[model samples]
Target: MGEAKELSQEEIEKIKEEIERLKKEIQYHDWRYYVLADPVISDAEYDKLVLRLRELEEKYPFLRTPDSPTQRVGGKIEGGFPTFPHSIPMLSLDNAFSEEELVEFEKRLKRFLGDENLEIEYSVEPKVDGVSIELIYEGGVLKRALTRGDGYVGEDVTPNVRTIKSIPLRLLGDDIPFLLEIRGEIFMRREDFEILNRELLKAGQKPFANPRNAAAGSLKQIDPSETAKRKLDAVFYASGLIKGVEIKNQKELLQKIFSWGFKVVPDWKIVKGIQEVIEHARYIYGRRKDYPFESDGVVVKVNDFRLREILGEKAKSPRWAIAYKFPAEEVTTRVLWVEFQVGRTGTVTPVAILEPVRISGVLVSRATLHNFDEIRRKDIRIGDWVWVKRSGDVIPEIVKSIPERREGFEIEIEEPRNCPSCGSELYKPQDEVALRCPNMSCPAQIIERIKHFVSRNAFDIEGLGEAIITQLVTKGIVKDISDIFFLRKIDLLKFWGIGDKLASKIIDNISKSKEIPLDKFIFALGIRHVGESVAKILAKRFRTLDEFLTANPKEIETIYGLGPAVAQSVEKFLRDEKNIASIKRMLQAGVKVLDYHEESEQRKKGALSGKTFVFTGTLKSMTREEAKKLVIENGGKVLDTITSHVNFLVVGDLGDRGTTSKLEKAKKLGIKLITEEEFLSMIKGS
Candidate 1:
């Protein structure tokens, strides 16, 4: 060991002051970057200062610690927020992204409250940027804190919450209330957040976007001390589990909370009229920077908690309160051009390329315009200045256009008179917004049709996507849909990435797809107005694809959702000379596209005999197309989503959101969930 050199007291104190200043400075930069989405210094410059602190800490082993800037982002949260179902569902707040929207929300509330002569006010609290928690107090002692999982059940996080300083160790009042659950956010202080992110950047890791995400990632920690080191603070702003409580209104509740030694958000108001409410909301919006913790937006609730019960809630959100979410980001961008893109099924959709601009936090260079009709309706034009916005920091959209600044030379574009891809005639039927090319021989249409035919909803071929399809098309390897069946292993690797195994799987899949049941064959053909439901009906109504093809416009027009226009389109499509030739070539190509009903009828007349089944959730057991196949093969029918017509509803691990509704409706209408075990046991060979 080396002899220690004694320093003057002033020098020692100065060194200590420098260490504190550096930490504080790093913390402020973190807030500026993560919380505000605005950084003052270059990333390279930020790293140098952080490196100095870390080096000093290393030399002064006593100063070396996990709580310091080094170990924040080392771990990840465990699988899924475990369910600890709250007595009340943690309903999401309705967003108001702008001040105008906030005013409108206030207007409607005041108007409604006026009817009852009970003017309502709200407690404008800090909408903390962290994971929500339900802190349970047993006899004025901190007993438990659970995460808000799915509005009911949440993961047990008692150990993590114990580390936060703001969370009270003991209850304030000795009035001896029974078990009480106070809900609030758990977040890292601004300073701690900066150090964490700075260390992350130095390690060549992607820094977190905000303190909210950091706080959330930290508190859900599997290790308690790690969460404690995050310097997480809590504000018990709301109530969840409560016993022996007498609460009249929100204001009194907040005041009682503050008096009982709790940290209440400052400057809460009970503004009644719409104007005052709007003004108050604006005040908060402007003062968001002044607050210590991160707040994405403000929450406004009807002050009279009684009126809250009266207002009730919608199926999705509450009626009494709404959150006013300020615009995440917005910018003016020039529209470079709008082009039509045709999907595999010949749906002509519009895509817009914008002059590069930043919207929200991401770069905005392109956006989907949806359809030609939507473009015309929005009056979007090239060379026009348009306002684009992003919600929740992603997905750019052209919100509005500035027509006043438009030049007189603005050209009015008409939907293409012909198919851009095939150079054939395009047709738009009556009452339909989309214009489609009826040409089956069109190369673009052929690839799209063939791709959809092999999609998860249709033939269930997995290996063939754009890369392979492009290679096949470009190499003159596959021209029409039927050409795919003839592809050899060597032909697949003619491009890059494909091997003998992949080529064989694709070919095997192609061969398997040929033996498709009648319903799949019908849908794979991409007929007009024939969605899965309509196709199922058509499949049952007409036993074969050829028979349906043979039916005239007058006979086909009678089908549900298929009118005279669709009937004409279908009839016209079948009669096309080129399409007829393609059908002949497909038949000769040895595609087993003809209905299997003929073979089934030859054996047992009622292929779909006595069983009815419904499918729910995403299936890992089989593709939805394959499940439908199982139903058809065993003399059964498949229904869309869930309906009364379905006899057995097949359920999977799609989580408990919309599944319960389907189950409830099924119970009301008398449908049941079929287990794979029970199904296999009951069906035997089926």
Candidate 2:
């Protein structure tokens, strides 16, 4: 090859201009896709742009910059993440769990300011459930990312943060600050977290208990590439240290951050007085699930930056802001018995059978101990009263045992030496905390697998409850999950109490379930670590069962949001002769795995999107529950309390409850009050 010719000054300057153009174009696309959740171009189009930019930067190495979009996943730090002192202390916020406490917080502010009847404007935002970090930007470029380690000092996580596409590598606009310290929360979306846990399980590794844990774990990863795979996101909420620009208030600061190509807290509002703050808190608490990420509470801060200056700081937290926490979804329940249950993977888990208690409307009777180690760590004992917390859709867990409430009757839980289902010797894996039976033929394992295959999120085969599954496994009629497809009505008739009608209905349901979605089919296979969410991702990527089966570990690993563990598990399952045979048998029995299609954008954006509604009093047309369901179905949210954010307040028949507090509050806030008929009409029209 001929020697490469050196470019002239004009050529270099043109190249520089081209590079800047590409960087700006890529940054705009990134902002649109990541920050706005609205992309102007397709993934392939975006990739080409990035590829072109990379090629140009590669040929012109002298023009390469740290703020380039291609520099997202940097080389891993050799030693470990370094620690750095923050420009200003990243103080924690005091918490208030009730309206009264919030009022008290406001009263304290008033008392300190010596203004008795002082009207204060407060900025309210969701307290995002994630790890807190401070980002230092020097001359519009990101300088450092640090975790909130002790307020004054934090561990540098700049490399890991760069991997987050939502977080900008450099500030946009010409009026950028010379030095700016932005504080924000790094969180994983619920959907991403579900997919991640599925991959972790597939790799035979322990899954994160929640999204918050997953975000924290992903942020601290040594490898930037690993962090990039996590699809972590962030939202900048507050500014710590700013040198060039001056912000008047919290709302203005948030807007400034948004203008600088960063996502601020969603649906943040400015309200007058403490009551409005309490109302916002109630609204947030009621519709927390509507958000993509977990939010534990609402952060209420004095809107005026000058007022914040007057309030100053406390020892560990800011006096201007207080976190209005949602009510704990926890209930004290006595553990009746500690039952050892064997999973489909033959892993023995300790489950605490609790005295029946209601938590967030669900009647909880049992909570997972996770493993023997968790039981020991929590010191959970049979007959001991424990605090069972049920957050969102996550399974209720024993937060901690109430040692003070425990009586002499409480018995310390002992690790079982034998599998609960099969009398096999139980052994704990060297690297895992779980004890396994190592028996694939264990009856409990078989029953559990069959149950999982027919679960609501899987094949959804109706009339096949746990009792029937247990009976099928015990009688040796159904040896495996695939056997259920070939079950004859005669075989079901042989079992006692199985009537002709029930058996026929079950067989009909099983037949109807043959034509299932690919994602459901994948989940029904009872593959370890492949949950419904992961199955959907796999289905979308592979499109067909044949494609998935033909895929090797390398091909599978190349897919975004998937790691080696998930790829290996999928490849291993497909390679297994028995599994393949079972799959073939199922196919031969007329199981058709249909291709997956994503929900249309129009359908995803419901008619009542971004609208908040509150229902009060009694309705003659429908129950409150029915009304709330309609709102949710139409992509609207329902809150228990009336706030400024509420678009409509649904009013029912007053009866003896005329001019209720909710109505008065709604009137005070100027929220639209709609009659029951109007509400019905609105939903019907939508």
Which candidate number has the best lDDT?
A: 2
lDDT by residue (482-505, candidate 1, tens digit) is 677677777886777776666777
Candidate 2's error at 679, in angstroms? 49
lDDT of 2 by residue, 490-577 (tens): 9888886677877887898899889999888988887765655457668878898888788778976765545565677688788888
Q: Model 1, stretches more than 4 Å misplaced?
A: 1-80, 94-116, 125-131, 141-149, 152-163, 169-176, 186-201, 207-236, 259-263, 292-297, 325-329, 333-386, 391-394, 400-686
Best of the candidates, TM-score: 2
Candidate 1, residue 601: how far the Cα is off, in Å: 39
Give candidate 2's TM-score.
0.53
Q: What is the C-alpha lDDT of each candidate?
A: 0.65, 0.82
Error of 1 at 34 (Å): 19
